[model samples]
Target: MERIKLHIAYDGTNFAGYQVQHNQRTVQLVVERALSKMHRQEMKVYTSGRTDSGVHANDQVLHFNSPMTLDCSSWRNALQTLLPKDVKIMHVEKVDESFDARKSAKEKVYRYQIINQREYDVFKRLYEWHVIKPLSMERMRSAAKLIEGTHDFTAFSASKSNVKGDKKRTIKSIDIWEEGDGRIIFEVRGNGFLTHMVRIIVGTLVEIGLGKKDETCITQALETLNRQVLGLTAPSHGLCLWKVIY
Candidate 1:
């Protein structure tokens, strides 16, 4: 059998999440079902990571072994025919068996989008967070700068996260910018992230931008490792797993 790697993009509005759950629709379940039909047997796909429900993905990666010798283009076309409209097979290729999507990943980039305006657009309501109050971009950027580099991100992670070993992760960079349409974007690149870490960081930055919290709160939270020291967790719909670098 040869390992096949696939680049997938999906709209996460309807699915429960990336992983399979009993009686719940998921990206993995759908993809694996299509693969199983193609192989005439059960098929399991390993992903780079999981995204929460309502969180989209631009280039989520996964891998599975198959005995079929179909070419890359044929595999893509066959899978696309079986998958739903919300999920697309961006690319497909054969890979060395040594490459495991999750363990081989070097970095991940997540983007959080917010529409800061009094009136929200119906089309973007499901994709972007709608915040009526004007946000201070300068304040948010200042707080984001403090979040760069390596630090224990316990305060930014979800309290219910199942990770028990280590909370420390390295953040390569955090970029906050604004568009003319009153849209604020937060793009963060990191070695890895704990569950809801990016969402919590965005929430804290939003609070800082709205003058609800001071920038120093980031420093204090990192030092204290207290979840209460940070702001609320941002909604999952606003965040997307943008890319994964191997």
Candidate 2:
């Protein structure tokens, strides 16, 4: 059997999420179904990670083993024909048989977009969080700088994440920038992330920008390991899995 790596991108507006669930449409289900149809048997695909419903992906990675011998171009064309219009196969290539998408991942970058305006755009509603109130970028940027480097991120993780042992993760950097159109983007890169970690961080940063909390709150939260003091878990639609590094 040959192991193939797939680079996929999808508009996650309609699907439940990345993983499969009984009777629920999912990115994995569609990808596997397409592969199975070509193989004439059940086929399974393993992804680098999961993205919640309404969250999009620009460069998600997955892997599958196929007994049938096919070139990369042929496999890409076949899968593209089967997948829904919202999802696209970016690339397909042969990889080492020992490689596993999730385990082989080195880092991932996630972006949370916010529209700091009173009015919302119909086209961007599915991809951005609309905030009517003005936000202080200086406060948000200062708070973001505090979260860099390795730390126990339990305070930023979802309460129901069930992460065991040490909850330490290394955040390489975070960049906060605003577009001319009044759209703000928070991009975070990390070696790993707990469930809802990036969203919670963004929420807290937004609160800081609103003057509800100070930049020192980030230091206090990390030092105290306090989830109670953390800000909201920003809506899933505002966030996207921007890229996965190997």
Give me the candidate number with maximum lDDT.
1
Q: Which pairs clash inside model 1?
A: none
lDDT per residue as tens, model 2, 1-246: 999999999989999999998999999999999999998999999999998888899889999998989888998998899989989999898999778999999999999999999899999899999989999999899889999999999899988886688899999999999887889999999999998899999999999999988878788889998998878989999999999999
Q: How accurate is candidate 1 locally (lDDT)?
A: 0.95
lDDT of each: 0.95, 0.92
Per-candidate TM equals: 0.99, 0.97
User: Alpha-carbon error at 229 in model 2, in Å?
Assistant: 0.2
